[model samples]
Target: MESNPAGQGPALSGNVMFYKKPEPLSPEAHGSLGVKRIDQPLGFLRSAHAVPVTVSEFGMAAASFPVIFVGNDKTPVAVMGIREGQNLFVGADGNSDQDFYLPAFVRRYPFVFASDNQSDRLLLCVDREGPMVTDQPEVPFFENGQPTKFTNDAIEFCKEFERQRRATMEFVKLVDSYGLFEQKSVNFTPRDQNGQEGPQQKIADYWAVSEEKLNQLPADKFQELRDNGAIGAIYAHILSLLNWQRVIQRALRTPPPGQPLS
Candidate 1:
C-alpha cells in the first residue's frame, strides 16, 4: 500500500510492549523487508505472562485461562502465567499447548495499528526489530513498489483488531457504570510431601467483575445488559476466575529456579 516515507507521517510514541522499533510500512523504507517463517513464531510470548483480550474473545479465552480486568482502563487480560517474564502456556519451542485457545492479541504479533494524531487515520506498522522480519527472501512485504498479498492480509487483520479493541473499551465502561468491579487477589500456598500447607503467598492483585453485584442489579439494568449481549462475557469473566488455580498448577509443574518441584 502507498505510505509516507520513513521520516514522514505522525510519529508513534508511547511504550508499546514487544515492539522495539515499530515503523510505518512503506515501499520506500521497507521495499526489501519481509518476514521469514520461523520454527518458533510464538517464542515472543514466552515472556508475556498476561496478554490483553477483547470482549469478543472472553468466552474463548476464559476456557483456556483466567481473564482478569486490570489498571485504570480496566483492560481485560488473560493470565498465561503467575510469574513475571514467564508464560506457562508457551513451550520452549514457541508453540502453545494443543486445544488451548490463543488470544488474537498474541497472534497479531510484529504488526500493530498506531493512530496518526494529525488525522483520524490508523497506520499499519511493523516491528522492524522483530525476529521474523528480515531483509531476505520468503514472504515479500512489497512487490513492484506496492504492498503484496501478505501485507494486505496484515492490514485487514490489524483493522479487525482495532474494531474489537474499541468494542472492548465500551464493554469495560458499561461494566464500570454498573459498579460491578471489585478488587481481588490470587494467592498460592505451598504444601510439603506430607500435604502440610505453608504460608499463603499472594501471586497477583487485580480487579474482577463481582457476580453478587451483577445479580443484585435492577431488573431493568440486568435486562439492558442482556439485550446488549454482554451478560455472557460478564459471566465468562467471573467463571474464568476459577482457572487461576490451573495457572498455579502449571506454575508448580515448572517452578522457578532454586525452587523444588512439587
Candidate 2:
C-alpha cells in the first residue's frame, strides 16, 4: 500500500481525447453541411491510446477497462490500449463491441462544449475531420440560417456533458485535497536465457488513488467522503487495476510498439 509521490502524471494528448479538429459550428462554415445519421465505424479510434472519462463512468468503465487518472489536472481516463497509438477495443474492422459500455467521451466525439474565455457561454464545436461531416445530404446542420433539430440536440448533449465534466472536476479536486493520490508505475519483463522471467521493466507511470493514504484519512473526513458517494468510486478505481492484466494480454496479440507517446 505504500506509494511514491511522482509529483504529476503525464499529459494526455488533445488529439486522442476527441477534439481532434475542433471548429466552432457556425452557419458560415457549415451552412451547406448535411451530416447524416448513419451507422459508421470508428476505425480512427484505433489510434487513440486513452480517452477522457467522467466520474459517473467510473463504475461502468471499471467493468471493462482499467480506469486511471492522468495529468496535473488528474483527469479520469479509461485505458483503451496498452501500447501507444493502439486502442485494443477498436478492431481492425473499425467496430467496438456493441455490448460493452461505451464511455460518454467517445459518444460525444465530433462535438464538444468549448469554453469561450471571452464570454461566459459555451460554444458548440464540431470536428472538421469527422468522417460524417460533409456538404451532401441526410442531416442538415442549419435550415434558413438557424440550427436544425439535429444540431440543437447535439448542442444539448454537449451542454449536459459539460455539466458532467464540471462535477467530475469537483470530484477530482476532492480526491486531491484528501492527499490520496500517488504516482504508480507498472512493469513487465520477458523470459530470460533459461526461460525464467527477466528483469522487470517499467512501462507506464500515472497518478492513482493510494489505498494507504485512503485508509489514513481523518475519521470525519472519511465519513464526509462516504456521504458524498466518493467512497464507492475510490474502491472502484482500486479494483479496476485488475483489468490492466487484460490490457497487457491484448497488447501481446497486436502490432509491436510503434512511436513513443506521452
Clash count list over all predictions: 1, 0
lDDT values of the candidates? 0.88, 0.75
* Model 1 Cα shift for residue 32 (angstroms): 0.6
- Residue range 194-241, candidate 2, lDDT tens digits: 557656666578899999999988899999999988999889989988
Model 1 residue 171 CA deviation (Å) reads: 0.3
Residue-level lDDT of model 1, residues 182-215, one tens digit each, is 9998899866656688888888889999989998
Give lDDT for model 2. 0.75
Top candidate (TM-score) = 1
The deviation in Å at residue 50 for candidate 2 is 1.1
